[model samples]
Target: MAEKVVMAMSGGVDSSVGAYLLKKQGYDVIGVTMQIWQDEKRCDIEDKGGCCGLSAVEDARKVCADLDIPFYVFNFKQIFKDKVINYFIDEYYLGRTPNPCIACNKHVKWEALLARALFMEAQYIATGHYAKITELKNGRYALQMDFNNPKDQTYALYGLTQFQLKHTLMPLSGIEKDEVRSIAKEIGLKVFNKPDSQEICFISDNNYGGFIEEEGGKKILPGNFVNTDGDIIGKHKGIVHYTVGQRKGLGIAFGKPMFVKEINPLTNEVVLSENKELFSEGLMASDINYMAVESVKEPMEAYAKIRYSHKPVLSEITAQGENILCKFKESQRAVTPGQAAVFYDKDGNILCGGVIERAV
Candidate 1:
């Protein structure tokens, strides 16, 4: 008998194609869609970018029908609100930025969805994530870099544990985005030409401050903007409205352009400084998950990316008990707290990653 594989279909072209590929591989393919949130209209079908949205479930259903597979919709709204959305709000409230996608992948897709797949007797759980898993000779699983486009590689997947990597499948790991779209078109999938969801699904607009204010029910008070010398130059709408390295929307006209150096939540102050202050030589991180190797007992040389869009820079990483220290070869700019710092080997294998604690 063929092994049963459950595919998390998001009603997107990539996941739709993933379902097709699994069925063609002769596996007992089962398509599962997670209903994670209720829409503003309280309708079963909404256009929200969340995977659990009604439209996505319908899309997955359509693909499953075409593939002659069974379809299931699991409601994960309460879990999503407690784990992902609440965590995001708490992080922002604490004056730290959080990546909801990372939390969603860690807690929702891997933990919750995988559990559901197992309950259904699935041998493997697959997704459209552009990542690869390799079994090494040492009898360990390694999450390798995607072969499609280096720029599109999601090194954030370093958080994946060996157990999860063992049963996880990424169909789009080797195929480029263009080719995936082409395949979807050839297969006559409805979402073949659909644009990728870029914004945080819960937030209809990108107004994070507005979301916080509406949810928290606390009006952000106006505060003073001070320079490095402790001189107040202008007034800011609120500390929550600014972030490190923010240049525009300051609403102040200085002789030269000034950028947000830091936000002091304690004092409700937004500090403006010259661009030079934004660059830092090193950082301390915690809440780390090491995948490629067992643990880092000493300092090891590797490439590190401070932000998602930034290129990886040469760095030496030292494990300090529960914390890790990353010393960059060159000064990196705007190393924001709460963002993850992912390490990689020269060959692009994910070493590990953690949340930024502080920058030096």
Candidate 2:
């Protein structure tokens, strides 16, 4: 009997093609779409507006039918709200910018969804993520970037444990997105030409501030904009409306260009300063997950990325109490709080990653 593999289908080209490839490879494939959110005001899933909508569910069902595989929808709305949505709101309220996608990958896809796949006695769970996993000696695994996809998603998957990596299969690791679409077209899948969903799966109109206030039930109050010298320059709309390194929408004209240097949620103050002040020498991160090595015993040189789009910079990381301190070789700008600081080896393999707690 062939091994059963549960495929996480998002009703998009990548996952649609992923299902097709798995079935063709002769695995007893099962397609599963997660119904994570269903808010009419935010996202109309019935209209195929977002990943979790009824439209996406139907599209995934059609693809499974075409491939002659079993299809199912798992309702993860409550778990998603508790884990990802609440965490997003809490981070923003604490004057930090959280990466919801990373949180969803850690708490939703790999955690809750993986558990469900195991419950069905599936040997492995697969997704369309453009990342690769290679098992080293003695059951150790390492996550690496997919060369075919320039938009590497390994940063979002740093939280994956060895157990999860062992049971996970990513079919699109070596396939480019365009090639995935081509395969989808050849396979006659309807979602072959579906435009990629850009917004957060749960946010309706991409109005993050509005959605946070409405759904999170948190009242973001107005505050004062202060400069580096501790002088009040102007009043801000709300502290939550701004982030570090932002310059354009301050609504204050200081004659010289200024950027958001810091945000103090407790004082309800947004600190403005010259663009040069945004650069930092280093940062401290917590909640670290290791992939390449068991642990860092001493200070060592590595390449680190503060955000998803940031180019990895040479750095020296050392253990600091319960957190890891990363000192960049050169100053880095806008090392925002609540963002991930992923460490990589020289060969572009993910070493370990953690939540950035503070800029040093």
Candidate 3:
């Protein structure tokens, strides 16, 4: 009997073509679209942005039909809200920046969806992420970055559990975006030309402040913008409205340009300074997960990325209990808290990753 695999299709060319590729590899692929969000005001899922909604269901179904595979819609609204949306809001409220996509990947997609896939007797769950999952000789799974592929997604996937990695397959690893789209076009998938989702799916307007307010009745509040010297500069709309490294939309101008260097939720102050002040020697990260190795008992040298689009930098990582301290060889700019800090080896293998706690 052929091994069954569940392909998480997002109504985009990447996932659509990914399903076809897996099926051609002789596996029994079943396509699934996860319905993660729905709001009366933000209902433009059919338009070229974000995943989820009924349109995603329809588009994914059509692709499955073309591939001769079964397709299903998995409702993840509650879990998404609980894990991703709530975490995002709470992080901002705490004056820390959070990556909701990482939360969604860890909770909704892999943890919850993978459980359902296992229930369906599928041996593996796959996505269109441009990262490779390989098993090392030490009997562990590790994620590798494709240096040649510009669309590398290994950063967002570093938080995945070992079990999730072992049961996961990413066929799009090292494949360029253009090549994937070309395959979709050749296969005649209708979503071949669909634009990639840019904004957060639930926030159609890209106004995170508005979304936080609408979903509020939570602790989002207005505060004072201050300088690093603890002197008041201006009034901020709210802590959620501003992030570290933000220069525009401050509504107040200094003699020269000023950037937000820190957000202190306790004092309800947004610390502003010159752009040069954003540079940091190192950062401390909590909630760490290791992939390339079993554990990090001693300090190690590796390349680390603070954000998805950030280039990996040479750094030294030392594990301290539940957290890891990453000291960079060179000064890094805007090392914001609550974002992910993913470490990679020389060959681009994910060594470990965690949520950045502070810039030290």
Candidate 4:
């Protein structure tokens, strides 16, 4: 009998093609769409953004029907709200910029969705994530860079646990985005030409501050924008409205362009500084997850990415108790706290990753 595999279909070209590929591979493939949130305003259907909305569900259903696979819609709204959304808000409230995609992968897609797949007796769970899983000699799984587009490779998948990695598969790992689109078109999937959803799915307009206000019921107050010398240059709408390295939409005019340096929530202050001040030499990361090996014993040289779109920089990493400190060979800019710092080996294998704690 063929092994049963559950594919997490998100109604995107990558996922639609993922299902098609898995089905063709002779796996007992079943398509599962996670209903993570509801469209309260009903405006997102027209917006063509936000994933996990009603339209995404409809699209996933259509693809499953076309693939002749059993479709299942798992309502993970409560889990998503508690794990991903709440964590995002809490991190921002604490003067840190959280990557919701990393949290969603760690908490929702891998933990919650994988558990649902296991409950359905699936031997493996698959997704459209642009990551590769490789089995090592010691019966462990390691995440490798996707063969498609190195720039689009998802190193954030380093957070995936050994068990999750062992049972998970990424069909889009070997194929480029254009090839995935072509396959989806060949399969006549409805979302073949659909644009990728870039923003947080729960946030309709990408107004994170507005979402926080609506959910938390706390009105963020106006704050003073100060320079490095502690001189108040102007007033900001709120501290939450600003982030490190933000230059546009400051609503403040200075002699020269100024960027947001830091947000002091306790004092309700947004610090502005020159673009050069944003660069940092190193950062500390906590809550590290190691999939390739047990732990980093000696200081190892590797490439590290401070953000999702950031190019991996040469760095030397050391494990300090529960935290890992990464010192880059050169200064990096906007190394935000709560964002993940994923490490990779010389050959592009993901070493490990963790959340940025502080920049030194």
Candidate 5:
């Protein structure tokens, strides 16, 4: 019998092509779409940039039928709300920004669905993430950048464990986005020209503040917008509506441009300051997960990326007590709390990553 592999299909060209490629490679492919978020009354099937909906489920089923593969839609809505959505709202309420995609990839797809694949006797579980996993000389697995794909998703996969890396497969690693769509077209997949999802999967309209308020069951009260020196300058709509490095919509006619320097949930104060205050020389991160190696025993030089789209900057990292401290060679702008700071080697290998607790 052929080895069985489970593919996480998102009803997009990337995943559809991924399934086609894996099936062609002689594996028994099973397509699974996660029903992560669905509120039939409120969610519109025609939403511009959502990943999960009635339409996406239908599209995945159609692709699976065309490929003659078995398809399944597992309901993960409650788990998503408990793990990813709750964390997102809690982070914002605690005066920090959170990346829900990272949490979803970690807790939902890799953990929950990987276990499901194991139950089905599947040898490996795969996704269309633009990343690669290669074996190191030490017989360990390393997550590396996908050079052929411009949109690198290694940042989101940083939470994956070593065991998960060994069992996971990313078929889209060596292929470019445009070429993936081309392959889907060539294979006669109906979603060959589907647009990529841009917004968060759960937030249909992209109103993050509104979603937080509605789901979290708490109203964000207006807070005082103060300067760094504790001088009240203006009133903010709410703490959840602002983030670090935000420069607009302050509703304050300050003489010059002012940015959100910090958010104080304790005193309900949003600190506004000049643009220069947003830059930080370093950051402190906790919940570190290392890859390509077991742990960081000494201070090592590496390139660090503060945000998903930011370019990697040179930095030196040292293992502190229960946390890691990253000192950049130069000041990095808007090193926000609760966002990930992923470290990488010169060869584009993911060293490790952690949550930003504070700016140094």
Candidate 6:
């Protein structure tokens, strides 16, 4: 009997084509769309650059019908709210910027969906994430960057557990983004040209502050903008409206250029300094998940990515008590708290990752 695979179709060209690819690979593919959007009209589906909406369900259903495969809609709204949305609000409230997509991929996509697939007797769950799963020489599963795919997603996916990686399938690991689109087009998929989802899917206008207030039921209060010396320079908007290294929208003008150097949730202070102060030699991270190894007993050479858009930098990794320390060879800029710090080996295999707690 063929192995059963659940393909997560997000109604985009990548995942749509991913479903087609899985079927052609001789697996019994079942198409599934995660219903993460709320019942109320919180976002514009057509304008969404990412995924999740009524349209996503219909699109996935169409793709499954075309492939002669079964389709299902999984109600993941409660879990999403608990794991992704609430976590986002809590982090911002605590004066740290959070990546909801990363949280969604970990809690919703893998943890929740993988559990559901297993209950249904499915052998594996798959997504169109532009990453490759590989077993290291140490017999541990880890994610590798697909250099062929321009939109590499290994950063957001570094938190995947070993079990999740073992049971997950990425059919597009070696496929380029353009080729995925071409396959969708050749197969007559309507989402072949659909725009990719960019901003937070639930936040249409990207007003994170307003969304946090509405959903979190707490208003983000105004705070003080302070210099590195602890002197208050100006009154500013709420802390949630700003992040480390933010220069624009400060609504205050110093004599020269200035940037957000840090944020203190305890005192509700948004620290400002010259652009140079944003650079840091190292960062302290917590809640780390190891991928290619069981643990890091000593400092090791690796490449560290502080955020999604950042190019990886040469770094040394060490375990400091329950947290991890990433000391970069060259000082990096805007080492923000609440963002992920993903460490990769020399060959670009994910070593481990953790939530950045603070810059050292």
Q: What clash count goes with each model?
A: 0, 3, 0, 0, 0, 4
lDDT of 4 by residue, 228-321 (tens): 9999889988766767888998997898989988888899888899999989999999999987767899999989988877888999999999
- C-alpha root-mean-square deviation, candidate 5: 1.3
| Cα RMSD (angstroms) for every candidate in the order listed | 2.2, 1.7, 1.1, 1.6, 1.3, 1.1
Tens-digit lDDT string for candidate 5 (1-360)? 988999998888888888998999999999999998676434444555356787888888999999999999999888888999999999999999999999999999999999999999999999988898988887878789764456889988888999999999889886788888888988798798878887677776777788888888888999899999999889988899888998977777988999998999999999988888889999999999888777889998888999888888999999998788999999999999999999888778888999999999
Local distance difference test, candidate 6 = 0.90
Candidate 1 lDDT tens digits, 1-360: 999988988888888888888788788888888888757443223444445577778878998898789999888888898898888877776677788888888888888988889898888899887777777666777777653475354655667888888888877777777888899899888788776765677776677777777776677888899998889999988766667788988899998989987777888788888898889999999999987777889889988887778888999999988888999999999888888899888767778899997787
Clashes (candidate 1): 0
**Where does candidate 4 stray beyond 4 Å?**
40-46, 147-151
The lDDT per prediction is 0.81, 0.86, 0.89, 0.83, 0.88, 0.90
Question: All candidates' TM-scores?
Answer: 0.94, 0.96, 0.98, 0.96, 0.97, 0.98
- Model 2 misplacement above 4 A: 44-49, 137-139
- Model 6, range 1-360, lDDT digits (tens) per residue? 999999998878888888888889899999999999854266667777457888878878998898789999999999999999999999999999999999999999999999999999999999998889998889999999765556999999988999999999999888888888899999998888888887889988888888888889887789899999999999987998888998988999898999999999899999999998899999999999999988899899989999998999999999998889999999999999999999999888999999999999
Off by over 4 Å in 5: 40-45
Clashing residue pairs in candidate 3 are none
Candidate with better TM-score, 1 vs 3: 3
TM-score of 3: 0.98
Q: List the residue pairs that clash in candidate 6.
A: 49-196, 49-197, 49-198, 50-197
- Least accurate 10 contiguous residues by lDDT in model 1: 40-49
